[model samples]
Target chain A: MALAKVYVNYKQSILNPEAEAVHKALKRLGYGDIEDVKLGKYFELTIADGKSKAEMDKEINQVCDKLLANYNMENYHYELVETEAAQ
Target chain B: MALAKVYVNYKQSILNPEAEAVHKALKRLGYGDIEDVKLGKYFELTIADGKSKAEMDKEINQVCDKLLANYNMENYHYELVETEAAQ
Candidate 1:
């Protein structure tokens, strides 16, 4: 099996309220050294076997676009890692 | 600057409604081959310089405990990568 670990975050041009709130809180809590904090969603997907890397990538992108991320507000990127099923 | 990519996910023993909902939706969308889907929060933190890795790790853990993750219901882990300040 293959696993795709996806990270989705708001576009840099967009204002992320959640991140801003957290950043302010961090500063208030005396974490003044933290330059920035960007918050996002992380997803772990277990992909079935027998697909080429290219095919899997395509499927992953389709999933991200169709179900996972809101493209107007967020951008997503993923890293694929192979996994072995228990014998 | 140093970057810490934190991933916070609910413990396996706990029931995650968000993941369950997404899993069901994926199946409805014809992604039956996806064995499972786990959702979590990803945080990108920009840490200031002049701190050793050990010091940063300790501070990261403190921040995670106090502000980021709910230790009672969720578990958090992170990978630290050194980043050069933009010239």
Candidate 2:
């Protein structure tokens, strides 16, 4: 099994000027569908076999804490998506 | 063919406080792997068939300009990695 990660955020966080510029351009493009446009990160990782879901989950948790997450300006939530084989 | 995106960041741009904290922790971890670690974003997308590379590149540029990239404090660089099948 493999693990993937996705992060969602507003491109401009009152922190990133680049995000703000994109936000302005998006507004001009008439994508008025959204009130605020946020940007996020996504990751897809392949895992080694022979480990249970629980073990994988533990490792993933550690990775998120140790490497994947910032836990300050960016807010993150995670989910597990099954590939066709698993289904 | 499909489109994939990867965004690299320093984690802490002297802008994101959370990324800064994580950077500090990493330094203390004793891995001593490097002087600094930056965080990045990665995306993998499945594209509809029948599009040429140039066509896809155009669309990707639009997406990055209109959405994915902030164009301000955060700088972004992109590359496309072919999948195993293509190789």
Candidate that scores best on lDDT? 1
Stretches of model 2 off by over 4 angstroms after superposition = A1-87, B8-14, B81-87
lDDT tens per residue, model 1, A1-87: 988999999999999898899899999999888888999999999989988999989889999999999999899999999999711
Please give, as one word, the docking class of candidate 1: high
For model 1, name the residue pairs that clash: none
Could you list the iRMS of every candidate? 0.6, 7.9
What's each prediction's TM-score?
A: 0.95, 0.45
lDDT of 1 by residue, B40-84 (tens): 999999988989999999989999999999999999999999999
Number of the top TM-score candidate: 1
Per-candidate Cα lDDT values, in order, are 0.91, 0.50
Per-residue CA lDDT of candidate 2, range A1-87, in tens? 444444544323447555456556656875332233334664433444566777667655665666665756555565654444421
